[model samples]
Target chain A: MLEAIINILSWLLLLAGGAFGIIGGIGLLRFPDFYSRMHAAGLTETLCAICIIFGLVLQAGISLLTLKLLLILLFLLFTAPTATHAVARAAMIDEVEPVLSEDSPRLVDYEDRP
Target chain B: MRDTIFLIVLLALLWLAISGIYKPAILLLGLASLVLVTWVVIRMKIIGEEHNPTVFAWRLPRFWLWALREIVISNIHVARLVFRPEQISPRIVYQNVHFQRPLGKVIYGNTCTLTPGTVTVQLTKSGTVIHALDAKSADSLAELERRVHWLEGETDEVAAKDAGEERR
Candidate 1:
């Protein structure tokens, strides 16, 4: 029973991870601009990678494989965001004018105020 | 230095954990290596009591939860715009960041890059430079800074407490 439960959990985790990766890939391909694509890439790195790693751990049945999987997860969690931050910061410094949502706070007025 | 030893021990423990082989002698060696590494890391100012595992034990999960939510929302938003390319308005923007530590700065810089539609081009002590595919991404990066700043603030507070202890 326990083994069956583990198998089910592993499958679920794998599916979730794959779904996230697919969405991210689609977002990368379809996004209008570079920044949007970048956002998608970051999403895949953390969400997709994490889910898949977790799934693999379940399937590996508690051994060195699990530990290695954990290490990869740890490394990804630490590095992915840092990489994302670097790219965005570089883009902004280059003076990329970002698309604004209609409801986005008006910067001109905010700066002009008091 | 003690840091070198600490790093070596960390590597060995990681090896044992991944290998899942718990022989008695291996266990002793791992522990001894860890102790030596701890001593080295302390000497080299690489690891300390403040930024210890105990602190990360509390902080990392919280960070992951927040990052996950941000990724989901951002991915969906990017997908919408991708399907309709008309939404793109590629441009560059500058924003101010208030991170005091180098680690905080790196975290902020890399996070921006990892997100879709934005890439970090330059980073300095004052703030960051980014190029976004659209205004939305730029705005998102700006908003992200607020969160990073908040996290940095927490780190600073902890570091300050550690510093105080050293002085005493």
Candidate 2:
């Protein structure tokens, strides 16, 4: 009975994670500029990957596979942010301006004040 | 010497966990490679007080839990914004951070990037330049900065008390 329940929960998590992944892919295409798109991709991708891996861990049970899945999760958690930071830094270095609305003042201008 | 031993033990454990093979030849090979890696690490002079495990031994797990919670919350926020791209008002903001150590600054910058809706674009001596998708996202950074400072062993109450004394 417990196994059956675990199976159902794992399936639910997998489905939700897949949905998130699809949504994130759509977001990547829809966002206005590079920085915003990076936000969409970086944020959702990490969550989606975590969700999917957690589901897999549930299916694997208390074993080496579960440990491996957890290690992958930890790897992703560390590397994804590093990769995102690198890309953002490179973009800034390349002089790519983020698209800011007229209502929202540029950060440089805000820093210059006071 | 301590860092070398720690690295060797960690690498060996990792090999054991992944390989799961007990053959003598494979075991010897794993041991050989572990020694080689440790030697290279020592020679490279990369292992220092900053990389010392003892520095973060107690605090890291708690900090990771807090960071995980923050990540989940921000992920949901960004996911909502993704659904309504019109709501996103992208802007870059500068935050003056006073993390005394370089490692603290790195942790703060990386944590900001890990959280949704904000990315650390640059880290200067005076402050961090962050790109946020909205005003709320930008505002969230101050709290993150405080938590990071605390993680680096700077308690908020102590800082606040010091400020109050300065005011007097």
Candidate 3:
């Protein structure tokens, strides 16, 4: 009974994670600009990856495989943000201005204000 | 001296965990590689206070929990924005972070990027330029910066000084 419950839970997590991955991909294609697409790609990707890995960990139980899976999750969590930051910095260096709405052109330049 | 031992033990443990082999020859090979790596690390003189800043170690797990919560919250926020693209009013804003250490600044920048709606596009000595999806997201960047400062164990006086400078 317990094994069946665990299996069901893991399947649910995996399906949910797959759904999020598809949504992220659609968002990436539909978003208007680079920065916005990055938001879809980076953040959702991290969550999706975490969910899938967590599901795998549940299936693996307390074993060396679970340890390796956890390590993979940890590495992903750390590197994804760093890679995203690097891409964002590169975009900024290339002078890619975000496409803002007309009414809310409130770019707070706190550095220049002082 | 302490750092060297810590590195050696860590590497040895990692080797054992990864190999999972009990044969004498493989164990000898692992030990030899470990010794070689440790010797190279020592020769490079890289293990020091800067590399291993244990001062903030005690606070890091708590800070990570807070950060994870923030990430989840922002992930939902951004997910909503992705679904309703019209709601996104993306803009670039700057926030002056007063983290005295480069490690703190890097952490702040990475955390900002990790959170969904805002990305740290440029981290200069003066401040961080963040590309945020909306005004609310940009405003939250300041809060995130403050949390990072707290994680670094910075005092309120320094934070107040930075805030005062921004007011000018």
Candidate 4:
């Protein structure tokens, strides 16, 4: 019964993580500007990774693989932020204007790009 | 010198943890590699007392616990914004660094970036310019800053500066 429960729960988590990932993809095209798009990506990137990895961890149980998975997660957590910071900093230096108000940014839709 | 030893110990522990071998020869090899790496690092002259993150080890657990909770909240907030893009009022604004140490700023900047609603755009000696998803997120950076300060157990810049003056 416990094994069955763990299976169902982990699968549920995995499914939820996939759903969030899809939402994040949709958000990438939907957000109007370079910076807002970052929010969408970063949000899902953090949550989705956590959900999927934790689900896998549950399935793996107490083992060396579990330890390895956790170490990977921790490393990912560290690198993702640093990468995000680098990208944001680069954008700023390149003078990518961010939307400062609610109504409209560039309105340059993703569909326009070939 | 202490940092070099600490780094060696840290690298040795990581080597053992991941290698998972109980052989005398392998252990000796790991020891040699650790010494070699530390020597190269020291020769490179990038080592500093500030680079020693041993102090940070103690402080990280509480900070990580708080940051993880913040991530969940920010995730929900971002999801909501994604569904309703019109709700986002994105703006870049400067937030002051309360902690005096350079490490505090590093941690604070990364923590800000880690949360989706608020990204640290640029970190300067004085402060960080943050691109927040909305006004609420922009304002919340203050609270986040406070938490960062509490995490480091460091006083505001002014007090720290005053203490430094007294030391001199």
Candidate achieving higher lDDT, 3 or 4: 4
Question: Model 1 segments beyond 4 Å from truth?
Answer: A1-12, A26-37, A58-64, A79-114, B1-9, B22-57, B133-136, B153-168
Tens digits of per-residue lDDT for model 4 on B1-168?
887766777777778888898799998998889888888988998665554666766666867877888887888888888899988888766555657677788888888888888887777777777788888777778777876776576645534554798999
Q: Per-candidate TM-score, first chain only? A: 0.84, 0.89, 0.89, 0.86
Best by TM-score: 2
* TM-score result, candidate 3: 0.81
Isolated chain B TM-score per model: 0.65, 0.82, 0.76, 0.82
Query: Which candidate model has the greater DockQ, 2 or 4?
Result: 2
Alpha-carbon deviation at B92 in model 3, angstroms: 1.0
* DockQ of the candidate models in sequence: 0.30, 0.53, 0.43, 0.35
Error of 4 at B158 (Å): 20
lDDT of each: 0.65, 0.82, 0.78, 0.79
Q: Write the per-residue lDDT of candidate 3 for residues B1-168, one digit (tens) a residue.
A: 876777777788878987888899999999899989988988888875444546578677867877778876877777777788888888777677778788788889888887778887778788887778877778787677777778788756545765898999
Tens-place lDDT per residue, model 4, A1-114, is 999999999999898788878888888989989888888888777888888998999999999888888888888888888988899888877877876785433322122211
By TM-score, the candidates rank as: 2, 4, 3, 1
Across residues A1-114, which tens digit of lDDT does each residue of candidate 1 receive?
A: 999999999899899889878877877777655655676676588668877998999888767677778888878877776666666556555756455545343222112322
Off by over 4 Å in 2: A103-114, B156-168
lDDT per residue (tens digit) for residues B1-168 in model 1: 443544565567576766566899878877787677666766777653324333345454655566667765665666566567676666655666676567667667666665555666566667655656667667777556656655654535534544798999
- Candidates in order, TM-scores: namely 0.62, 0.87, 0.81, 0.83
Q: lDDT value for candidate 1? A: 0.65
Residue by residue across B29-69, what tens digits does model 2's lDDT show?
99899888888988888875554667766667877887878
